[model samples]
Each structure stands twice: as C-alpha cells, then as structure tokens.
Target chain A: MAEHDALTRERILEAAEDVLRRFGPQKANVVDVARALGVSHGSVYRHFASKADLREAVVRRWLEGVSAPLKAIVAEEGPAPQRLKRWLDALVTTKRSKRVSPDKELFAAYRALFDESGIAIETHVGELARQAAAIIEDGIARGEFRPVDPDETARALLDATTRFHNPAHAEEWSDPGIDASYEAVWRLVVAGLTV
Target chain B: MAEHDALTRERILEAAEDVLRRFGPQKANVVDVARALGVSHGSVYRHFASKADLREAVVRRWLEGVSAPLKAIVAEEGPAPQRLKRWLDALVTTKRSKRVSPDKELFAAYRALFDESGIAIETHVGELARQAAAIIEDGIARGEFRPVDPDETARALLDATTRFHNPAHAEEWSDPGIDASYEAVWRLVVAGLTV
Candidate 1:
C-alpha cells in the first residue's frame, strides 16, 4: 500500500505539472490535475490534501532543475576556477532557457507561487548562495581567488552576473549583442575573483 | 494661450502623479486626475493624448527622482574611486527608500506602468548606465584605474551591485544584516575597479 501510494503521488504531480503548463497557476487546480491523470478528485486529495499543498510540491519539482545540476558541478571538478566558470554558465543557461522555453507559462506560474511564499524563495536563493560559497572556498584554498570572505564574495559574484541569471532581467536577455555583453561581464568577474 | 496652456499642462501632471500614488496606475485614469485637479477630462487629454501617455509621463517623473540627483554626484569633485563608491551607495539608498516608503503603492504603480511599456524602463536604465560610464571614464583619466573598456566595466559594476538597486530583490533588501552584505559587495566592486 505504501509503494502504491508513493507512485500514485508522483503520477499526480507529473500530471499537475502538465496542467499548470497549459493553464496558468491561478486557474490550475486539483480538479484539473486529477482530470489530466484520469484519476478521481478523491484520489488526488488522498495524495495532496489541498490545492495549495499541491502547488508547493510542484514548485519544489520546478526548483530541482535549477538547484540539482549546479550542486553537482560544484562537487565534481578538476579545478575550482574551471568549476566556477562552468557554474556561472550553467546558471545563465538555466535562467535563459526557462525564460524562453515553451513552458514559459509554467515558469510564470512558479514565480507567482514562489513570490507568495517568501520562505521557498529565500531557501532557494540561500541554497544557490551556499553552492556559490563552496566554490569560492575551493578557489581560495587552491590560491586561485583572493582570500576574501567566501560568503560575501559568493553573493557579490551572484549579484554581478544577475542580469544573465535573474528573472527580472529576462527580457534583456534576448537583446542583440547580449552574448557579447555577457562575456564582457564574465571576463570582468573572473578578473575580480582572480588574485 | 501657449503660456497659459503650458501652466495648465504642468498642473494636470502634478495632479496625475498625486492620483497615481493614491489609487495606483490601473485605476488612476484621466478622470480621476482631472477630479483631483478640479478640471475636466478634456483638460487632461489636451496635455496627454491618451491614458498611456499619461502613465508614461508619470513613470518618467518617478524615474527622475532616482536619476537626477545621482548625475550631479558623478560630476562632483573627488577621487574617482570615492565618487564611484558614493554613487554605488546612493543608488542603493534611493531604491531602498522607494521600496519602504509610505508611497510604496506609488512605487508599485510605477513598476506596473514601466513593465507594460518597456521603453520607459529601458530609457531609465540607459541613462543610469551613461552616468556610471562617465564615472568610469573619470577614474581611467585620473590614473586611478586600469585601461579597461569604461562602458563595459561600468556595466559590470552596475550588474554586480544590482541586488542593492533592483526592485525584484526587494524582499531580500529587508533581510537582517543586508546592509553589511551590501557594503561587502561594494568593497569587492571597488577593489575590482581600482588599479
């Protein structure tokens, strides 16, 4: 019974993701998710107690895409500087794809939901910053970066690259020559971080 | 008639700003502005052809408060590094005050207006970038910084410090110890810009 319930819950979440992409967050509800999964409303309720609870779970799934891959890069690497550069590129690519992806509606829905719940947003950012701090720590120990406060330097680096990574600057991401501009910013960042 | 017309137009704009702050952009129509000014809707329309024009004007006025004062600081007499630091601090201060002020509803209304019309936001950003570039050029000329591309470097500096200035990060702005984080970020920025 436990195994069956877990599978059913995962199936409902997958269906809910599909439903959210089609209808924005405001309109996507438990009923629509159940219909998509070909399950009764009572079955979805057995899995997720309320629509709010289901939306939060969907947000967690959405966040995993951005959080999981970057954490991996930070842990597995030949050199800290190389890992940091790749990490920056990964962050920019993740944000850029989400902004222009076919699931842009889903992206909007997730942003709206996350905005309503500050802890989720804070936790997501805190995780990213923590990952960044780890890379900075690696660089310092290897003598690649200056011996600055790792936490502060990580936040600075993140803020510096925000135009490429932050959702608020998403529209500017599509501008002509934005790639060159991004490279210019990246070069300055690497220069700053290097001793 | 032209002189009186100019005075009447200015009066309409002042009243429109008041109405926008009190009622927000969506509901602050020409009629409301006219009522605030004790004038007719036709009078407001005579100055602004449509509701869009009126909203755009209000956005421009809101931007001037942030842009105008800072431009003078860029031209003030001081070491380029000191000027740059002050400029960075001033931008953050302006944005923070706007976020927490009792007129925060006014701030939200302006953001909504600018978001709908990208031109307003772009113009505001372009002007600020120009000011930063000027400060960078001064730093280079004064032998205080390396021979990097001033325009590109200025952009990098602005993007790096965005957490302090951008409205999207407003929630994080209120975080405990945020000011110290901002200063730490500022130190890294100055270290990067200086020779």
Candidate 2:
C-alpha cells in the first residue's frame, strides 16, 4: 500500500505517464502502468483509487504543465498590455506545439482524457481565465486599457480567440496564412483595450 | 421521374425537409420522405438521386436560409462600416435565435446533417465567408475601415467570432451573460477596423 509511501505514489505516476505515452490513453491500463514500474496493480490502486482517478491525475499533470507558465507570466513584472500579448502568444505557441508540431499523440491523449476528467479540466480552465482576468485587472489599474469587468473581459477574450488557441481548431491553426489570422485577432484585442 | 415537373420536385423537397425535421437525419430515409408526401419512393430518388444527395439538398436549403438575409444586408444602401456592424449583429442574432429559441430541435437536426452533409456544409461556409468578404471589401473601398485584404479579414472575422455563432459552441452561447459577451466581441471588431 502506498498510504505512507509518497515516493511510491510519485514513481507510479511517472510510470503511468510513460505507459500512457507508449500505449496511449485509451489502450493503456493501470495494470500496464504497474507493469511498467515492476509493481503489482494493487499498489497502483493504493495510490489511485481507480483507473479513472489515475487518468484524471495524468490529465491534471499535463494541464498544469500548460497553466503554470501562464500563472508565472501573470505574476511577472511588465507593462500589462505587453505582458498580456506575450502570455497569449505563449499560450498559442504552446497549444500549437502540443497539438500539431511536436507531440500530437500526447495532445490527442489529452483531448480524450479531457472529456473523461471533466472536473480537472474545468478547474484548469477556471485558473487560466483567472490569470487572464488578473492581467486585465492590472491593465485597467494602470490606465492602459479600457474600464471593463476583468472577469467578463477575460471570458470574452478567451471565447473570441478560441480558434487561434483551441486544440480542436488545430488543423486550421496550420493553414498557410494563420499568422495573419493571429495578427488580426491581436490587433482587435489591443485596439479594443487601449485607452 | 419528377424532373419534368418543377412543381413536383419542389413539393418533394418540401416534403423531404419535413421528414428530415420529424425523423432527423439518421432515421429519415428517402422512403420516409416519400411516405410523408404520399408519393412513390422512386419519385424521391428521381429528384435527389441518392440518400446522400437528398441530405445535402436539405442541408443546403437550411444554410441558405441563414445567409440569404445577410446577402440582402450586404446589398442594402448604407455606409460599409455601419453595414458591417449590422451584418455581424444580424448574424449573431439569427444564429442565436435559431440555435436557442423555438427551433432548437431543427438546429440539432442540422448539426446531425452537417456531419452527414459535409460537402454541402463546406460550400455553405465558403459562401458565408464570401459574403463577409464582400462587406469588408466595400468598407475598405469606402475608406471607413482599415485597408486589409477583404478575403483574409473575412476569414479572420469568422474565426474570431466563431464561438458566438458556431453550432459547436451553442451551449456556451446560452449562458446568461451571452449578450455581454457578444457586445464585447463587437466592440473589439469595430475598434480594430475603424480608420
């Protein structure tokens, strides 16, 4: 049992990630994860109550990998508008890379897990939107952007720019003229916010 | 064959729409449409050629219903900028009203047909984008909006506002705050395009 063995739990998670990567989320099982780490499947259950829980943890880890950097960007010292632009650029690039250029298999895995791990994903989106809201709030305080409810603006921004950054729109993101599309969206955002 | 009688062909299509509406894309076959119209199934085939063709025609008719009003708006006498706003506002309203109000059943039916009627849907999207481009081209020529390529800007605009009008995002659009979200998006579009 991993009840008191935190290291064993972490190791199992690492092994689970590897097994999932190798076999994919749909085909990968807890027994396969345990086999990857040379442990019985019972110990895996000691750490994660069920297969669904393990999938949720892996998806949480992947989503955290994305939002953590944005949270840091929100905290960084800079002009709010510029920081917002940089943050959005980072979000787009990271999403595109995850979804298309480098690791589509993992992205595909995440997409499948997202529906299964609904609460984990819902929480992650809330955190990211809050980060956007924080940046908007900062911009308004500095008198650089228009006065609007930061939370509403954040949702609007996310919803409006969904195609540019959403994984579901990955195919369109790779179109020959996608850069122009991104620029047009950013121009609109900046124009709308500038005092 | 009903081909020689234009009125009969129209009557068959009207009955097909009714059958598709009632039984939906999956259950509504050509035979069902013919049964609804009290005609021989062969007559339905004479008009549509195949079940796929019948579905495509139904989807094309549905999509045309959405865009025909916009085409008129594009041709109406007005300043380009004002017309553009009117066009977008009209788009959001029509899309929302169709998606949410009395005909949600039909919207669901269309979503089902959209998958089955891919070419029809693709052609419909291209036509809508061209309509947007025509409005943008007029605005650019009138010197009311920025000097951007009408076609690219039209794609960008459609991409940006997709969530508000796209069927995939219909659930989110029903959120209580959707009106505010639509207003925020319009503000950005108008601000970004103003000379």
DockQ of each candidate relative to the true complex: 0.49, 0.51
Model 2's i-RMS, to one decimal, reads 1.7
True contacts kept of 2: 0.56
Write one digit per residue (lDDT tens) for candidate 1, span A95-190: 889866797887787777877766776678788989989998999999988898888888777777777887777777888978887787777777
Best by DockQ: 2
Span of ten consecutive residues with least summed lDDT in model 2 chain A: A1-10
Model 1 score (lDDT): 0.81
Query: Backbone clashes per model, in order?
Result: 1, 0
**Model 1: DockQ vs. true structure:** 0.49
Q: What is the C-alpha RMSD of each candidate to the true structure, in Å?
A: 3.3, 3.7
- How close is every model to the real structure, measured as TM-score? 0.85, 0.82
Docking class of 1: medium
Local distance difference test, per candidate? 0.81, 0.79
Score candidate 2 by TM-score against the native: 0.82
Question: Per-residue error at B152 for model 2, in Å?
Answer: 2.9
Question: Candidate 1 clashing pairs?
Answer: A160-B160
Q: Which structure among the candidates has the greatest TM-score?
A: 1
